[model samples]
Each structure stands twice: as C-alpha cells, then as structure tokens.
Target: MSSESSQLHIFFLPMLAHGHMLPMLDMANLVASRGVMATIVTTPLNVPLVSRTTSTPTSTKINILTIKFPAAEVGLPEECEILDSDNSKDTMPLFIKAVGMLQEQLEQLLSAYNPDCLVADTFFTWATDSAAKFNIPRLVFHSTGFFCLCASTCVGLYEPHRKVSSDSEPFVIPSLPGEIKLTRMLLPDLPKTDAEAAYIAKIVKTVNETEERSYGVVVKSFYELEKDYADYYRKVFGRKAWHIGPLSLCNRNSIEEKLQRGKASSIAENYCLEWLDSKKPASVVYVCFGSLTKFSDSQLREIAWGLEVSGQQFIWVVKKHENNAGEKEEWLPDGFEKRIEGRGLIIRGWAPQVLILDHEAVGGFVTHCGWNSTLEGVSAGVSLVTWPVAYEQIYTEKLVTDVLQIGVSVGVKKCDGLLGGSIKREAIEKAVNMIMVAGEAEEMRSRAKTFAKMAKEAVKEGGSSYSDLSALIQELSVRRLHH
Candidate 1:
C-alpha cells in the first residue's frame, strides 16, 4: 500500500459460518496490516468469535460491526446465527433468505459509511449490485482456491457431470486446467426439497448476475500452487482477478502464538500441546474434518479402528454429539480411546486447528480438504491424506492429490449414503501410511514443504501475492481518488 494516498477504508462482509468468517477476517487483518482500515460486518454470535482472534492485544486496524441475525423472524432457534448450526441442514433455505433480507440494512450501511471497497462473501451475491450502485468495487472473496472454483464453475456451465453414466464411473471435464478426473459419486447433489430448490435457485440467479459485475473474484491461493487454473480463472472471469492467498500465511506469528498458548483451542491446551511436545518430530498425524463434517457411529468405529490399526501417533478431533450422557467415548468405538490412549488423543470438540497444524510434531494431516484446512496444511508444510466428505471438496481433493502431488486420497467419496457405508479400515490405513511412513511419503513431504515455502514467500515483500495485494490497493486507491 502506498503511503502517499489516503487510507483504504474497506468494508468486509463474510458468511456467518466459521470457515467463511475466519478467512475473510484474516484477509481483513492482512489488509489492515498493510494500512487499510477494515470494518468487518457480521452477526452477534460471530462477533465474540472474531473478538477472540482480533482482541489479541495488538494495534489492529480492524473494526467490528454487527447487524441483527433474523433468528425469530426466520423461524430459527434463538442464538442461531452461523450457517453451520445444528438446524442449518433443515433451516438452510430460511437461513439463506434471512441473510438476503439483510441486504437493505447492508445497503444502508454502505450508504452511510461509504467504503472505498466492499470485500464480500460469495453467499452475499447482492453486495456486488450494491457496490455498483455505490460506485465502489466489490471484490468477490471466495474462501477456496482457484482450482476447485474454476472446475466447479466450468462443470456448472457445461453440465458435463450429467454425461457420466453412473456415480462410480470416472469422467473428465475438458475445461479444467489439468488432467483431472472425477466420479459422479464424488460430486454432491443440491437441495433435495422443492422449497429448498427454489431458495438455491435464487442464490444461483443472484450470484450469476453479480459475478459478471464484480470487480474481481478473489481466491485464497497463491500463483505457483495453481498457475494453470489461475490463468484459466482469469480467462473465465474476464476481469482483473487476483490470487493473493493461502491467507493463513498472513498471520504466522499470531496463529503460532495462539496454538502455543492453546488459548482458543477446542481441547484442553495444556494437555494437547504437551502431548504434541512428547511426540517425535514430524511424527503425529493430526486428524480433523473441519466443522461441517458429521460422522456416523459406524463410520466413527471404522475411523477409530483405522487409527489404531495404522500404528501411527495421531490426534483426532471428534465431533461431539448432541446427547452424550454417560461414557466419554460414547460416539466412538467402546474401547477406542483406552486402546490408543498413549499413541493418540481424541479431542471431541473444536481443536485449535491452526495451532495443531503449526506444531513441529504434526507430519501428516487427515483432512476433509476443506479450503481453510487445505490452505493451512499447505502453509504448515505437512503432507495430507485428503479425505473429502462434502461440497466441492472432491475437486479440492483432486487439486491436492492429483495436481499438486502433496496429498494422497483416502477414498471417502461422500459423507452421506449408508452413513459413510463403512470406510474400510484398510483404505484408511493405506492412505495414512502413505503420507505418514510409506515409500511415497518422502515425495509428498517434499512437495508439501515446497508448497509451504511458496506460501511463505507469497506473503512476504516482493512476492507474487504481495504484489497482487499491492496492485489491489493501488487499483482501489485510484478509484478512491477518482471518487
């Protein structure tokens, strides 16, 4: 950012989900670090979450602003604002509609604050139109990488997915940048209900309408990671798009400190970090399936047995069930924890993921390939056993395993259908061993480390991502000057 110009007061609007919110907030802080005044627009529940990160006693230039979450009006339960709420699966249509209902309030805020730029979540597609009306640039902040988004958008346009005969059969979409193959089973279906279908239709309509008008589509990926897809995305987007990401790289120190202090970690930090400390260097496999993944009891048993059978030191973050009265490992195999007591620790809630990934002992990640975790895993330089469970993550799994060669797939086609339908312990054992201790492990680890270096360099001065952000700031500064 050029100091000769006035400060860039940018307004950031993130999706209410933690995955979406966390990255956009991180982008906000990144810009704020570069002398931009960031105003993050979020709801009440997310406010506390944001404060926990932003309140880390520094002269952060970010400000938090709130709008009422339409819980009562939308027939949602009280205190439910995030998109990943327990009832979100049921109430998703209402939730999307309710978020759209905030458009007027958002427009009003835009009119009042008059930000130079509006960096908005993909869910809030209406923000682009609002930015157009306000004569400000609305950068579409995609929380994922270029490869997955490009592939999905191309698939949506061509509907090549329909050409595939069966879910199990492999098919190729020519529009994707690399030699990527996908099975129909790997892709997820949209809303099943007619009412939900209508709501999703509106979201699609609005997003398509606004994407043509958005200033740029922002991906949280670096150029070297996805050069071909980055070029393809620019050609498809037909705008001055940027790839200033692996956003986790922007706050290396703060995240390291948080993981070190175990302050905001989901488990008992003292126990968790101490356990990691006890492990050999680059030895433990940290397993988490992000926030949205839910495993069935059968699946849990397979996973527990798989980890035990793999004979590797591991830390697994298990999702807590709504009702847990007696046994601590009720959702897991009956004697699961006791059997792997010394080798693995299962934290049945949110773990300080960023901390765990950054730990020196963490050599392998059993991830669902959620975009945030992917970027974080890359930044941390850990080989990944890609276990995609939902969404367009299958494409991301391809991005890592096939394209980047930094990950190996665990053959988790879908989290649904027969309750994960028994993820054979052998498949899990093979993938874990591949990344953790097999012959291919060195190649994967080398690539992971290489990508990690790229991620670190991308955020530093004079790097590709650094130049892109500078270009964005300069482009916006000119816009502000003209205004």
Candidate 2:
C-alpha cells in the first residue's frame, strides 16, 4: 500500500467506564495494527486507566489525546486526579455533558494532526455535530452488543408508555427493522418522570439525527451472532452498519505484558490465575460483576452461601468498599471461607479478569452479563451463569440465557408476583452444582467451548469479524478519498 493508501487517521471517544473504555482501546489498537493512525480522546481521569491497559510507548504510532473536562468543579472530582475511585456514579451525567464542551479542543487537535475520520462512542453524540461543523466524516461506535443497543432504542421508542401503576402490564416494544423482540423488562432504565422522559427523548432524537448525518455505525459484534438484527439496522436506518468484534482478539498476546507494566494494584495479584491453574478442566466457575454495579448486603451474603452450598471451586471478585468495611471477615457465614479456603478464592477488588477467564481451569462464569464481560467470557469459551444487576444488563442477561442459549439464568423471576428475591445460599449452591457436576454442566461446557472457538475463528483472516473490519476500513478509506 502507498503512503496515501495506508495513511488512515481516526479519533476514538469513549464513555468513562472500564467496560466502555477497554473495548474502545482494543478497537483503536486494531485500527493502528492496520497501519492507521488512531487518536483516543479521553477525560483526564480516564487517561491512566487507558494507559494502564494499552501501555503505548512514546515511539508507538498511535496518538492519545487526554482532554480536560470543562467546569471541572461542577462535579466529577476525578477530572483532576489520575486514579479516582471506580465506584463514582454521580459524575456520569456531568461527564456525558462535558463531551460537548470538548469540541473546540478536539477541532484544534484535529487541525494540528489532520486525520481522515472520527470514530466516536455512541454517548458522544455531540461529536457528530462537531465533525459536521468541521466537514469531518464521523462514525458512531457502539461499544456494547447489537442486542443491548436495540434494547436502549426500545426504551427510547417506548418512553411515553412507561408509567408506575399498580395494574400496569409489561409494555411490548414494536419491532424495529433490525431489532430482536424486546419487552419493557429487557430494556434499560428509562427516565421515569415526564421531564426526564423528555430529556431522554431529546438525546435519542439527537443520536438518530447524528447517525443519519454520519458515515456509518461500527458495532462490537459479529454477523453470525446477530445477523438478523444487523441486517435490520442497515435496512431500516438506511445507514451502513458493520460488525467487527470480540475486539479482545488483539489483547490475547499482550495481556501479560500490559499487566506487568500496569499501575493498578489489582493487576499485580496473579492469585486468581494461579488458582484457576490448579482446578480441573471446566471444573471452576469465575464470578465477577463489572466496576459500577452494586448489590445489597443481603444479596451478597446469599451469593456467598450459594457458592458454599454448590460445593464448586469458584473465584469471586467482591468490592471491599461496597461491603461493610468494619465487618469484613465477620460478614461471611461461620467457617465459610475456611470450608472453601483451598477450593474458593475471594478477590477483594478488581481481578485480572481476562487472564483469569482464559486460564485452563475456568469452565464457567457467574457474571452480571455486562457487554464487555459477556464478550470476554464468550471469547474465553466459558459458560455463563447470568445475574443481571442494572441498566442494559437485563438485556445482556436475556441475550446470554434466552437468545444465545450459551448459558443459564439464575434468580429469574416469573409472573408469580412472588419477587424471586435474592439468590439464597441453597439456590446458589444448586445452580452452581448443576453447572459444575451435572450432565447439564457438560452440555453448557460444550456449547461454551464451541462459542469460544467461533469467537477465535471470527478474528482470523477471512472470518466474519475480520471481513467486517476490513469492510469498515475500506468504507472509511473510500469516504476519506471522496470527501
């Protein structure tokens, strides 16, 4: 390829969560691997997190632009610091709004570097307007799965009907061109009040309008996984949609290297991986929820008991701060840790999740079904025990348990109005036991292994994800030349 042909420049703007940033970074790395110059625009607070994950050297071709958030004092204390506590939720709205204010800085950076196109996160809808103002072609990158995006769209479309009433029935969302059948139960949390609903409506409208004006949509999913929905997006929206994912493919080789140089304390403890090494093939379950989701004390205790009852070798990541700090060891049931000491490992903070999942001993995952976690689990060929906590997670749980049939759902509530409540020790024990020791466990293991193989194949040359990525680059390259 000539210098002109190979010289592709793209900017990546990601939301400020670990789940969102990690995949975006992986995509940016993929672009760079293809000889494209990629610039990742992130908040000052997230720069360290990205740096820790990528460990991009000064000599590396890719550029990382860490822009300061405006009205720094308005909220979001992390705006000033490099490593803020991961549990911060109050800053979400403010951080989202701040993306709009970074337009001037982004434009200045763009003019200096002169890139070919902008590839931004879905949350950065404002980037579309910025790109248009500067005559730069833009692409919206949905970091999550296609199903989750569709569920969010459903919430937007059905906003008017969401009312809290005693006799209210579940609202059925009309079929979107490329979307799967979804109910209100599977959707993300929508704005409840009329005022909040109007705000969300405005945001969704802006997303649709901006998407129409952009070059295309790039999703972190593959054609085989959601072919029907992918087709629906292209047909109904009249906008090009490409699936180029399981982005973690590129990280397989460098995960260890990245961890060695990563600044996060949690990354240093290789105990989880070491524990997995001791278990038999497909005998251990790995349980972790993404950074933001929280459970009540009762729920946490129930899960502990469940694991105890299941009598399975498991690795669980529990946040120290989320639990009662004072009663840390005392919180568990009598001799719980002792009974399962050698069999189970309880990681207090963030574990080296990808490394743990890829370990040979890990056969199943007890996950909150966050998109990134789901993709990681799938890529690792680990079956899931779905326990969705919030937001689009419910949709993710449905995808894993219902649509994909790759995993089983736990704590699922039926129409009995009994509120299935939290997973008790016995229920957890039973679920884990079935997945680990029963015939169903083997079936799920086989299915998970197959999916993992498919994920591997998808990233190889000529595979669906590989082809989609090639097509995305070609489309962007063509748009660059024509414009």
Shift in Å, residue 436, candidate 2:
2.3
Candidate 1's C-alpha runs over 4 A off are: 1-5, 190-202, 254-263, 322-328, 414-422
Winning model by TM-score: 1
* Candidate 2 weakest ten by summed lDDT: 412-421
Q: Which ten residues in a row have the lowest lDDT in candidate 1?
A: 255-264
lDDT of 2 at 365: 89
Per-candidate TM vs. native? 0.93, 0.88
Clash pairs for candidate 1: none
lDDT of 2 by residue, 1-483 (tens): 248455878888776666677788888878777777778887666667766666644213556787777746456554443222343445556656655677788778777766788888787777777787767778898867777776566556555334534324455445643334444443454456999978877877988888878878888887777676677667755668788888876777755643522236463455555666677987888888767655556767888888877888888887656556555554467777889889888877777777778888888888877788898899888788887766667777767776777788786442111112356676677767766777777887787788888888888899999898888888778977787
After superposing candidate 2, which stretches have Cα over 4 Å from the reference? 1-6, 56-60, 78-86, 158-173, 176-186, 254-270, 322-331, 412-422
Q: How much does candidate 1 score in TM-score?
A: 0.93
